[model samples]
Target: MHPQPESGTGTTAGLPATADGRTSSAPPSGPAPAGAPDDGRMTWYVYLAIVISTFGGLIFGYDTGVAGGAAGFVADDYGLSSFMEGVVVSTSLFGGMVGAMAGGPLGDRYGRRPVLLLSGLLFTAGALISAFAPGLAVLLAARVVLGAGVGAASVLVPVYIAELAPARIRGALVSGYQLLTTLGIVLAYGVNALFGAGQAWRWSLGLAAVPGLLLAGGVLLVPESPRWLVSRGRLEAARDLLRRVRGRHDVEAELHEIRAVHRQEARAGSGGWRELNASWVRPMVLVGVLVAFFANGCGINLVIYFAPQILQSAGMGSSSSLLATVGLGAVNVVFTVVGMALVDRVGRKPLLLAGAVGMTVTLGALAVVVSVPGLPGANWLSFACLSLYIVMYAVSPGLVAYVVISEIFPLHVRAKATGVATFVIFATNLVIGLTSLPMLDRLGTATTFCLFTAVCVLFVLFCLRMPETKGRTLEELEARFRAAADSRAHARVSRGV
Candidate 1:
């Protein structure tokens, strides 16, 4: 009973029903009609949906980066020490781990939309609580809540985007999640620099509620994942929804493909942690978790969670330091877009190798520059190396790690394994975010960067053992992993201790 439009884009005028009880305005005939063109063109509505959904990534960036500028102010206001500084910074991540574990089940059991709505609610509540908190305890508690929301958002957003998009554009649309992530960071840096002098830390923390509200409101207009609908046996509804998001022919074709995969998964019966414990599952999980671990562990968060502080330690004032942090956000955004363009052109593994080598070199140079001063413009060296590190990160692990997490596992154990992997990622982020200040104070920049450089070298060796995933479908990737697992299992049985 919705109102008709004067512009002629109405549901009755050929818009097809979708899985989530909504409809797309595209023809019901689906994407192709047989031997038609398969150029993988997308409608404007697809782009619009991506924009709204990736707001989840925006919140992630804002929450993580805002603290760098506000941490000193909050610490001074609440009389906190370095340990407390780390705790406050990392509290949200702890909540994120909790949320991630919860999100996977919720997303699978219910749908992406409901879990996303819950995440929005958590974000709103956390922002309000943190803004009004009177003590370190309250602030930390509030951050935990916020982190929970962030974690849920992180998992759901990309899953949602990937599910809805066509394969040809899937990487690009998912890459939008990373792009929006950079936008959030840039926005946070600007806001922090603008209000660094005032009681603006309150504003910084509280303003996060704005995006949460927007996401809640925006999601109302999105269609459910057509694949999730098929999994639930809502074929008619799925087909109708597909008609709107995709063309008539594309809808029918995609429905067949999704149904085939779902049927295969159902027959295989492998969607839980127990299934993951089977012989073929262990190594992939190990690789996924370690990739996530080292990606976060090797100084990425140390730089991100403590950028402003690092600049201050290198001798800039708090205000100037906050301003300088914006540069990091800029570099991240620029290089991420570049990296996204290069993903298909250059492939994933090569990018990681390049990023690792670049990270090691830049980090080593940074350590040397910090230690050996008085050689004319040595201070510029610190900022330059930091910028290079940011660029290296944007192009490699920072970009690929999440994509790998999403693609690596088989469908049966995808949610649980990813949840566990994401938990490890959050846990590592918490450790780095919390202990970084004490580490910085005790270790100094020279030693810290040197340690990080060594870590990067280890990452390069680890990545060498990882397989390439360029241009691989989810089903193809799963098949290869299953074969590898079965082979390993056969070996284990033969050894029989």
Candidate 2:
């Protein structure tokens, strides 16, 4: 019989099976099949690593969505003003800026595992502090700490999965992070509904600490990223890891390719923000920033952070609104899974286009419904449109943006460029969190959603310019962009002539 693996977790506790179909917990002692072909089935090792890493996304989803539900109770207890509410909501994004910037260097210098470990510790520290926070200031500080964890996790986890995975299933594997993020959001909503009514937002906030702790501990079981090892010139270590993960027949060949890529990158000069100003770099950066803006802009943050408040304004009780938000989270998770399943098959750009179209339709209908006064079941109609909006986003940009960040930039500059992109995302989110309520109060629901609808239109246009990066290797992608930049420079010189 095949060796029995450990219980609960899918991986075996002893040595993993050899490529020759033999099993052992002992390290490889022979020339392994490092370059051998795979069976093409999702390996147990790969899937488990993804499952564990996605917990980082869970923390992100929970922290972001939980605030919207819990903040209302916080406001009631402390009698917060619009400014104070915005401050409270925007704290995480502010910290996320630091985390996003920090993530790249940390991942590059320390490898994916250590940085992930740091993220988990930050998450635990942030969550515990927030749970017992006695004042608005304390809570905001705690949220900042937590945001750092989210920002780092957001960048690193997908990169980890992307680097470890083969091209055939990379899209789906990376998308696991997005799907889990949705689950985290949905679970947050459920937790809020279960605990928010009795002034139990503290419990809701504290609960996130559990997953953070688990992530911190669970990361030890996963392997260090081979690409990260290759970058550091640790060829022997990288080879060992690849052999174990991919099995023996493919190790030497994979290492040869990885080393060649690293040498090429080294010769290309170290990548920097200056590259982003180059012609091809300019368009890709624009694509990342605008996609991020629409992803968080367009009032999605407003809806998430203030959904319960909006429901209460529409005439539901606070508790009832919290429960309704839970329903919305459920829908969000389901559609996100659908999006994950489709990403590899459908490609990134098409899903984004579909999501943009869906956002346009749903948000437009929402504006109309919220505008009508006491028109039979207007509140329900508005709620339905809101749910629809989430459904569209969950399957499209919600998942796609993360994939783009994972695969778009060259490997050499990937960490830094993605950090910049993430900073833009959180910065835009901060603006949304700070101003969304005032926008809603001053502009009314109709005008507010109309603004989002306009953003959706812009998102559609911007997405059309995004390259289809599916099924492409990181080396191929980098070469394409570099060549494109070179061609543009030649054109400019010709024009000057």
Candidate 3:
């Protein structure tokens, strides 16, 4: 008889699950099929490890908040114009692109744990240096260093969690990254409200090191990814770790499935960066890449990074603006929990489509309200529009993009392809961040917002075309896409086109 794996939650304790916590359709008398998680109760150790690793995301959220919270103070001390303030705020984003471009190769070559550790160190160094920066140039350079670390962790964390999680609960577990990140943003905003009086913004900036330190220490306590170990030929170690993570002594079936997929990928000569353009691979990679790109285009990060500034521009006091930002950050945290519950339960595309429509409407409201001067309660109305926008964003593109990209690609090329996707996300974010203030200054708030509203419309169209990834194992997803590609090619040849 197969063990009835407990989800460690009272609600799911009686369900019978395969090795990795996926509910089996029947109580089979024999062994599971090759790709199943096998026979194991999903353990809290897996949960603990994933949580610790996801602190990398918290570090990212902290940086976004602390910088935005303190940008005005930073600008006042330096006597910076809007362009220079944007330059200071966006330097880390530019650094993120550079770090993101390198993150894939590093995670693929060095194991995920080590790369994560290095990212923590970079965050630590950058935070400390920025706290003591003597000039704009010094602070800008330190932000670049800090951005690189967060960039790498952004690529590494999602794939790391996806590989370790049971397929049944992978959606919720992976969403933990976004949860922690939002939590971090809230914490930073709180810190800003506390310490943002004078030059005290330095305190908010310096404290980012705390989460960075936690990220490194947490990685130290967890084992490396079993899938990556298999790729590196550490089969014995991979097998042992897999058994422990699955909570069963036997993982031969799962291990065999992983090996077989690698062998298939090898025989097909499909793992190289150049071959990402090949017919079988390109479709899925395009899906992942476009999903990543539009996720940022949804404009949640824009608010996270610039809410205080956006609010202050609308005739609000500095303290009132930071407090309003805290409220928005809370909305970001709450709805992300909603996303965690709904992602696997409903589906990826549906949540995203729903979000895009809501965002377009809210953004349109923002453009209309911000453009009209002396409108009654315009400050409060702007706050309401942003709050609603965060709700839409946090539940969909804000959370799901990372989950889809991490699991959609075949393992053989996952690192490189995910890297490319990660690079696009960071690059898109950089453009949004670097240009936000200048756009708000020159084009006016209403027009600037309308541009993002336009992007959400584009996001809606993309969601209609993107594939759903709910309930499918990584290996299953790869095979499904490859078969679809083959079918399309056959149809084209049949018509002699």
Candidate 4:
């Protein structure tokens, strides 16, 4: 049996059984780090797990980039009109919205790991159905399946990584998911080029299954989130797992921090859906919701979903337009890597503000270039401006929004709240995917660009007041919201309002 602590806190007394239903009779060595690196940091287990989990992102990115390139081909093969083509493209995002809503409660009920496994199954099945789909309706259904998987992965992966990482390194590790997403986009662009327009849409889409299979299998090898364990009242297992994850036996402090926070939350009865809208939480909660909404509103998806069509309208040929997007995909990947490196050091708000300024300027310039009407070099100039916009975006909101949503919520409500935020992300994303092409056709590309620029201006204003969340533990960050809630309660009492 474990020795009793002299302190009366009872931090380790009468702990519950682990999820596996085993209680430790004696203190034992922690779970072995899966791929213990020579660096002795045991966090290779973390790095390994993050890479494996983010494998879901590869398929998510592939769908994001491939759908735009493949849409025209799918339209041609099935004789779909412009409106129908938008429907085909957007069906998956609609599925993703459904998955985003479901992921939170399912994660809270089952566990994050099971949610991931289910997402992978959805990804694989969706890709296979879309690849050999013989008709229009079948293809739309397949896209929806794939979208549900992407939606679930998007919501849970950040929470998974954030909960696993140390405060000092948490931002960078969470940014790793975005890094994989960019790489997946680049891979999709390359696959689109190799398959040839209208020739191999099946192959381009079918390839997503490989990553899905990898994600499903890979999750079996990783540990469950320790916070999840502790929340389940499995403190004994949580304590041992923390030791392995952090590469040290002296994990009592961190374990206590997690346990203490949950104790307070339990006493306050804050775990249910109602707490999500409590006045104290409304401010930070809105922060996440608005960030998710605007991150998509800046019109990044227009490029991801319709870059070739936009470039083709600007005067490029089909083959050339497809090739150009490969370049755009490459730029997205490079800058996302840079953004990941910087998030921990330069801070989240600064990057969001700086990126907002750059996005505004570049988007406005692109509008002017496209509207010049046969101006010399308009297509290349549009490409130049669009490339700059991607650079601004990749380093700022592209990655920051997900990181912030994952890090800034009470532990009890974290996954559920993130699910709500990511739902907005997919919803805004769906709006762009479904309407952007129609908007471009009717509103004129220049006018559409201006609308996005206006959104960017609003984004800049939001950033001016958004809180910074770098270098703080999840427990520490949640306290800020509680402190705000407490201050308001005090004010109400003073005035007797």
Per-model CA lDDT versus the true structure: 0.77, 0.79, 0.83, 0.84
lDDT of 2 by residue, 1-497 (tens): 11222223333322255555443324334443354333334567777788889899899888888887777778888999876778877888898899998997788778898889889999999999999998878998999999999889887898898888877678888988888788888889888888865878889888889878877887998988888776775555666777677754355655555555556666565656575665656666767777777887766777888888777666667677778888888888888889888998999999999999899999899888888888777767768888999999989988888888887776666777778888888998998888888888898878888998999998888777778888776666667877888888899899995
TM-score to true structure, per model: 0.88, 0.89, 0.91, 0.92
Across 1-497, the per-residue lDDT of candidate 4 in tens digits comes to: 11222222423443433444454323323542343212224477788888888887787888888888788788888888877788877898999998998998788777789999999999999999999998888888999999999999888899998888878777878888888888889898999899874479999889988888998899999888988887776676777777778887667667766766776776666577887887767787899999898888999999888988888888988889889999999999999989989998999999999999999999999999888888888888888988999999999999998889999888888888998999998899888888888899999999999999999999999999999999888888888889988999999999999
Best-to-worst TM-score order:
4, 3, 2, 1
Residues 328-360 of candidate 3 have per-residue lDDT tens digits of 889999999999999989888899899989999
Candidate 1 off by > 4 Å = 1-39, 373-375, 486-497
Off by over 4 Å in 2: 1-41, 272-275, 278-282, 493-497
Best of the two (2, 4) by TM-score? 4
Ranking by lDDT: 4, 3, 2, 1
How accurate locally is residue 93 in candidate 2, as Cα lDDT from 0 to 100? 88
Q: Of the candidates shown, which would achieve the greatest lDDT relative to the real structure? A: 4
Q: Residue 423 CA error for candidate 1 (Å)?
A: 1.2
The alpha-carbon deviation from the true structure for residue 151 of candidate 2, after best TM-score superposition, in angstroms, is 1.0
State, as a TM-score between 0 and 1, how close model 3 is to the true structure. Answer: 0.91
Model 2 lDDT on a 0 to 1 scale: 0.79
Better of 1 and 2 by TM-score: 2
lDDT of 4 at 12: 44
